[model samples]
Target: MFFNTFSWKEFLLRKIISLLTVLLLVVGCENNKKSLEPITPEDFLIIAHRGASAYAPEHTIPAYEIAQQADADYIEIDLQMTKDGVLVAMHDEKVDRTTDGVGFVIEYSLEELKQLNAGRWYNSANPGLANKEFEDLKVPTLQEIFSHFGNDVNYYIEMKSPKIYKKMEEKLVSLLIQYNLIRANGELPKVIVESFNEDSLTRLHQLEPKLPLIQLFYFKEEATLSVQHYNRLSNFASGIGVNISSVDNDFIQEVQLNGFQVYLYSINNEIEMKKALNLQANGAFTNNPDMGISVRTEFEK
Candidate 1:
């Protein structure tokens, strides 16, 4: 009786419209997934900034082990070079802040840098969380990190002050090759190379097109990226990493619309973590992996 009430042409048109609606929803869902690929390629990523730097001195083996123990998705490392041309994991150009040394990281030989007590500063800085066992940890070279963690862990490495380190890109690529972390066959590594300098990222991208390179931006105030900026970064960067102060949901949505993932920097607490999730960011760099994990769990629920 319902069929008899409608013309055959009208029924055919209705079916076609329904089919188009289904098609649009599928397309919309696929686009949503594309925006999320950088975060574990499907799941959200928790990058342990400086190996859970909140609990231990950053860039030390103990810090890295703590991050791994918490099952972090990636460990974020800021790399600086030594005078002897060794690549070491360190966040600052000057060693004064985190170590018992007073000079630029590049001025010291690996042996010289190693002599500095890398973990002592944390005890004095955070007396409540101080540990006597952190007395004399050595700075870890890139090779040492590779040897320690192997392929079981993913690394989010930044070439800190890359221009200051001659052939830093080449040396980094060489080590990755030596460790079989990258291949000439276009197989990608779990590693993601990021930098604040566009030129540094460009050089690294040229070195390995298969590698995912991220361009980082800093802002003292609210952050925003122009359409032109997004266009330019898309030329080389797989995505962009911005300070939490610099981003909002609109920025995240717009960047994703331009076909790039957006990762926020330095989320250290549940409030900040929730802000990141609320903004629909792909992921964030966090100093407390366990807390990040818990916040993500609760937020999803």
Candidate 2:
């Protein structure tokens, strides 16, 4: 009886050792898997909507540079075409709102647009809320912006009304390649191509399979997409960029549960910004990168 009892004790000890070995292997694998997750809150991406428009004139070189200075993770650019078929960075379909020019942006050649003062109109008395520092800014081109900023900063380029310009995607992608911004050693300037039109985004995805695309929406209520549309987008888009008003805890949770990253846009107020952070949004697009970063820092504390 004593001999049999001793053998059973030895067998139990060996089984425990084997179980521990398996546990160690699983723990190691889990640690590596967590590391491989593509996105994280620690990234805390800050996209400067329209190149820090709150502080500078929107979509101008100066405004983009200001975004960089303000430590924005990405400078959002709006793509439009000139009469000469050149791709330029300006937000409006018409230049009347942001530029001294009175007609459509497409009506003027690149040369004519260059000669116009794109900045003076937004001076302290009007659009800029009377900030004189915004004066004399010029609209930037895709080429010029790439040359100045290089691949050091992230770019969130919006295909603003691409139907008007059939070659908008081709032009932007060609420029990206010319600058060697398409693929780099590590985290090559996270270029996020966003569009309201799913068809435009689908075309871009076909062109560049690896580049991340975001579905942008400006709905007044919850996301209007049916379950079928949402499923399709989930397969195609890396994430969704929603207007701040459209995002809430329930909606954020629903998307998160579906394994989609949610990014809220143009959040300027500290209160709303804090609410977004609480929702654990992947990122926020803001016109004031300085204020955005400041609020993010506070929230972290």
Candidate 3:
């Protein structure tokens, strides 16, 4: 009886040790997998804010094409899903501001949203920059943008209102994989995912750990971030994008020191663009990619 009891204990102990060893090996394998490289100040990306929005209607194909022509590093796309579960590029949650249509983007099907003129409102608002060709410019689908540009241009895509579009992360990741934007063999993919919603970013990080992510911050009033905040963000994101007014030289230095890139948004004026360059921002989201590229050239020289 004593021998039998000892044999059972020995068997249990060996099984526990073997289980732990397997777990440790699995953990080691995971740790060995390479993480996506963080974007550094040396990158000096020129992101087109809604694709040269200063020249044409925001998120329209013409604007994106113009930005590509102007040599922007990445064309930013704000994504929202329509009623039929298709992704389209538009900044506002409702199409009223940018399109002749008046309704929530989620409320209308892609075909229904397409019926409304997207570019006429821009022409009316910016009279001096208006063009007849801008009339009846339709809202573009994400597929359309991908088809038109392919991998020739990089994309900085924002998951707008991810909470509202519950399946957006899944859908976006699927499309990226389908389009071969998620590369294998440790090469950097041209697509970057960004969002103000941390959960959305987290969901993307889980789905594709290799996909580079930028966490966006919108500041209504000026504020400074703590080291703790930067450290927490560094756990999941490769970079941060903030409203240009929210950042200073010290802020940029601190964030960069902590191994995260800083990108400032919507800098259209040359003076502001030059200031951003002086501050050594890793990138600037500009409505005029031509001006952004030119300023970067002069400043770097």
TM-score of each: 0.84, 0.81, 0.84
Ranking by TM-score: 3, 1, 2
Name the lDDT of candidate 1: 0.82
lDDT of each model, Cα atoms only? 0.82, 0.76, 0.83
- Give lDDT tens digits, candidate 3, residues 46-164: 99999999999999999999999999988999999998999999998998899877989999998899898999988999999999989979999998999999888889999999999
C-alpha RMSD in Å of predicted model 1 compared with the true structure: 8.8
What is the per-residue lDDT of model 1 for residues 173-243, given as tens digits with 9 covering 90 to 100? 99988887763222334788889999998888788776778899998887766545654675677788999
The ten-residue window of minimal lDDT in model 2 covers 29-38
Candidates ranked by lDDT: 3, 1, 2
Model 1 Cα shift for residue 295 (angstroms): 0.8
Reference-based TM-score, model 1: 0.84
Q: Judging by lDDT, tell me the better candidate of 2 and 3.
A: 3
How many clashes in each structure? 1, 2, 0
